[model samples]
Target: MAESCSEAGLAPPPELARLAEGLTDQARLDGVVGLRPGRGGRRAAVLILIEVGLDGPAILFLKRSRQLRHHAGQIAFPGGGVDPTDVDLVAAALREAEEETGLDRSGVTVLGVSPAAHVAVSGFDVSAVVGWWHAPSPVAAVDPREVETVRMIPVAELTEPRNRARVRHPSGYTGPAFRIDDWLIWGLTAHFVDGILELGGWARPWDESRTVEIPERYLTDRRDTSGDVNAH
Candidate 1:
């Protein structure tokens, strides 16, 4: 529950295995395509989730405000469209994390970078960046306009085998997830989350049948809720 995760969010979490050397053959989803034809310039950003001490390790996720134009009320990693002032994707990620979660960027270390993801739904060429929040703290509600709720989910729970769901869209690609509590960790977040789990040699084989039909309506809405377009 969000209530429980918040309580656990107050404590110090342990370090996850950031051993990147063994992940050479990791299953990576086809990342962003050519920054879009007239998609203007590249806006890179880092989306870092901290697994503070509570509940093993907690992933920092955001519930976007319903008033927002895209992906309203969906659970997502706290980063955004890259900015011109950003030094690189890492800087943009940290900067965006601070703006969205109220977590200070001073103590966190850049672990590694995941393959860049282009959300077919929202036209965002996003790079999922992983980090360890060395001095994690309770993130105050910073910009209320975009973020409605800032929450964390457990590392162990999210990595559990039982929550496995193999989602096959009308498209050919299939993805996996460990649905922890109320959060359905699927789509791009699930894909990259699995990549991180692979860095720990924790990849568990999941059934191709375990399913969740992402509605067709989600596509036409043009929201980044699923991060990819269902090629129906």
Candidate 2:
């Protein structure tokens, strides 16, 4: 397959292009959390795949399969715990993307990585690798056991007041949330998405006063399951 940006008519979005032009390594170190300096927790990596769509630039997300033991039925980036054979975080992210979304790694341009964020629930430190899909590929749920559906959420739709809200956790933690159709994206996924939008300077002012509760069912079920202590 001819995997080239020109062949696919794909180009980086304006905001991303600007960031890439002015981007410094220090940008990844800013505003990151749970920075466990040592290496005790499991290592994991996720790809933040951005592409220029008809409406504009959008990000790719996945709805995890409900049948999974951990973080079931949750919205997450396509990633998992890094295997011993994985060379680095970027390789792990790309491998997981290919496994979960059928995304061709060759079609993606490595933009860099964000600081390591700890997922306390899974006891894993995840590094999010930001990438531009210069040569787009057909993305779908390659594994029914891991992925439920694939979504390319437009940046504009996410920043809209009607779709934005704050999700309150039972633990009294509050963070950004987005309502995309029937799916409610909250937790770590929402936090990462919110940060990325701001970093790209593509975020718009929305009513932050709007609030919603993270579904009790999700919280309760996760507590009962042995998957992980926290919902990633």
Candidate 3:
């Protein structure tokens, strides 16, 4: 018999611990968390802070400012490319999160990291680092230079079959997105959402027909966080 998905709780497994530990060691040498492109290319790292609560953990995602170039108003983790001045991948992640959403990093316990993701839009190979933030947020200020808004989706919602779907963008990319109530979490943010769910062993077989429809304005601005919290 196959293992039931619900058997896995909202905590990371030993595999996750091993991966996270390895990243720290590797970062000591290269001092970076990034994806290696096919050949000569640029790679960046993004931090997906998963705030675990009594109800489990909630994944933190953000909406980029509409005025930006590349992937504006698209949902993503609180991160950007690696800075040469940074000490390592973890530093880069914390720095970006501070710059993007001003979420205090002192309380975060990093569980581990998912595999590096390659993005064609920004031509970046990105490493999504997972951490647990234990503090009251509604967070702080978001830097106007990058992010515009921030949202948190409960981890349990990602495993719900009713919340998952393939978001087809006009850019010719049909990819993952989750609807939890009102937020349409697609693009890079969506990918990490699924991966984190799998890591927690909470991946449910969601019905594709039950996809949460994205509001027209979801593609343009910050989420309202009202009404139904759609899942993906």
Candidate 4:
């Protein structure tokens, strides 16, 4: 059974009730946690924004610009490091989403927050803020330098067995992955998506043994400029 952290008196839409109820700390969701020794304590947050579309519940994702120094050409949720002026992680998430994708903050209803997860590669403690797009407004990549595309992918397509697989990085790291057209969703982002599927009872049996290596194009030269590592 999923745990609940919903705001008092706010009822989530039926399509998201399960997820809202099941929402808990990322560690319980099987997300990456615990920082490596000697890592700094930087904080960040991401918005896991969902909406009920014609097909069903869909998630918002943005493709990072290939020109970025790190995590280039990768699909990620709209987010970034917490700003000092922001009241909390939730505000940082909404602000980042709005800046990256032109998301109308007024239309989003924050469900709750998933406890922070330690992203070792980036040395940041990141939180996932769940939200419902009850009244979605026009969204697009507001900056070509940071974001290249904005896509709303249906959960049905993501849960399909044919689109699910495991991905192996050259570092010997292997984890859940999802393939949509030519885009490969992997790393921490994929793990969160996988957890969401299971939490919402939207998961389907898939071949875990079927794995693919991270494509050369998606691999970054870590020796260069330091920036946010794979999707937050």
Number of the candidate with higher lDDT, 3 or 4: 4
Q: Write the per-residue lDDT of candidate 2 for residues 21-78, one digit (tens) a residue.
A: 4234465445644323314677777888988877888889998888886667788888
lDDT of 1: 0.57
Pick the lDDT winner. 4
Count of backbone collisions in candidate 4: 0
lDDT of 4: 0.76
Candidate 4 segments whose C-alpha is farther than 4 A from its true place: 1-10, 24-40, 221-232
With candidate 1 superimposed using the best TM-score fit, by how many Å does residue 210's alpha carbon deviate from the native? 0.2
TM-score each candidate: 0.73, 0.85, 0.69, 0.87
Off by over 4 Å in 3: 1-40, 135-138, 170-172, 209-232
The residue-level lDDT of candidate 1 at 8 comes to 32
Stretches of candidate 2 above 4 Å error?
1-13, 21-28, 32-40, 221-230
lDDT of 1 by residue, 113-149 (tens): 6556555555665676666666667785577777788
Query: In order, what is each prediction's RMSD in angstroms?
Result: 7.5, 4.0, 9.8, 4.0
Position 40, candidate 4: lDDT: 46
Tens-place lDDT per residue, model 4, 1-232, is 1112243345777888878667744444543332222144577788888999777899999899998767778888888788899888889889989999988887777776765666666676677777888778999999999899999999999999999999877766677899999989987778778878887889999988998768776565354224453443
